[model samples]
Target: MDDWRSQRIFRPVRWRSRYGRAESGKMHGCADLPGRMAMARKAKLGFGDQATTLVARGTRVTGDILFRGSLEVEGEIAGNVTGEAEAGAQVRVLKEGVICGEVRVPVVVISGRVRGDVYAGEQVHLTASAEVEGNVHYALLEVERGARVSGKLMPAAAGSGGDFADDAPTPGMPAAPK
Candidate 1:
């Protein structure tokens, strides 16, 4: 018994209570620890922790939407969708989604159809299934091979103070006067 008490393998068993519960309240083996820690970090950074507003398929919204965290659209929206600038806001339009009005967000991922202008403060990703009929204004833009945009693609000027003006002329149109 003295030899077993000095063994390292018996130390863990000795900490358990009569009910077989470990005093530390920690599991012996947990593969999801890393994933849980990652999620906790994301929550601390004010990202991926906020609730996501979803517009499901077969539904349609007629009024404008103003959000803070994230919005996922899988249906149709006839009005503007806007998110707070510099707030780590994000908007995602799924392949079955459709929007008929302007979209202004810090980050935007589009894989659907949009008939109006899009303004992204940080980045805009147009996936392969995306189709846009209006101009796109972005600080950083990525368009997949099959993505289609019928209007102008403009880059936001540095130090412009986040002003999204429709001053830039499109192709074959007269330039606006300064």
Candidate 2:
């Protein structure tokens, strides 16, 4: 257990290229070190860490969640999630996460799978790994190249009641106009 190879956490690694300074390359005869920009592809709606909550990987929640501050999901949620009335409330779904119900928040950063509608009063940011199967209602939206939204992309004014529940599509019918 004392061996470094048995640790699950990442250890900082620096490798020297042909030049004198440390750069990204193979280390001696071993594999390449972790890149410095490894986290650059992640999603961020700018809510920061005012407060934080975690739904960890391999865990599942069966009921709806109402939260304040930030909720970070790296697992599966079988119900809806909503943020509190205070400002700066947010939700982030990581690459391996999945949410099977609605998400209502001021800010949303999704890099995983969402199977229901999303209402973002402030902003919605979808990364290349995000896959959303339901409608997205947002004041502002940012989508990377590979992000996918199967339902409507509905943009509403900041205060015009964007979280309309009646927007669901009728079975076997054409989608609503944008």
Candidate 3:
């Protein structure tokens, strides 16, 4: 590492910019260098790190998942999913995917099959060909034409607001409340 202080004061040194400059008798305002580094470290996580992860087609996972990041499911998952409790967190199940367990997340967009309970804190979108046979509790919901939902629709329990509020649906025989 180049030690800024060890350099001769009379020698020319490149300070702020890439261009060279003759060193003066006193040090420049480089004293804030450490603070600038600290500031950069505290900026925050960017959109890339916060972007949703994907489970592509033909893949399968058979265990409970407690993910702290967003996920897009295009394969098969046979376990409980307690997703990250963050804004924009979502689980998108593609037409080829199948999930067979409980899923508690902020947003759920399903175009496949889910044979378990679902609690979406924000919204749930079920596209055509989506077949769900369990309980669904969501603040907002949308189901496309030809979608099959054979389960109950129940109101979410009070207290937990950002997911994890188990709201069992009433019964599959009757249409769920819109």
Candidates' C-alpha lDDT: 0.83, 0.83, 0.75
Clashes of each: 0, 0, 4
Q: Ranking under lDDT, best-scoring first?
A: 1, 2, 3
Which regions in candidate 1 have their CA more than 4 angstroms from the true location?
Answer: 1-49, 165-178
Q: Supply candidate 2's per-residue lDDT for 103.
A: 93
Q: What is the alpha-carbon lDDT for the whole of candidate 1?
A: 0.83
- Candidates' TM-scores? 0.65, 0.63, 0.62
Query: Between prediction 1 and prediction 3, which has the larger TM-score?
Result: 1
Q: Per-residue CA lDDT of candidate 1, range 1-178, in tens? A: 5785457443432245467965532243234357768987877776645658899999999999998888999999999999887557899999999999999988999999999989988899999999998989898899999999999898888886445755565689987442
Which pairs in model 2 have colliding backbones? none
| TM-score for candidate 2, residues paired by index | 0.63
Q: Of the candidates numbered 1 and 3, which has the greater lDDT value?
A: 1
Please tell me which model should have the higher TM-score, number 1 or number 2: 1
> Model 2: residues >4 Å from true position, as ranges?
1-49, 158-178
The TM-score leader among the candidates is 1
Worst 10-residue lDDT window for candidate 3 reads 21-30
Please provide the root mean square deviation of candidate 3 (C-alpha atoms, Å). 8.5
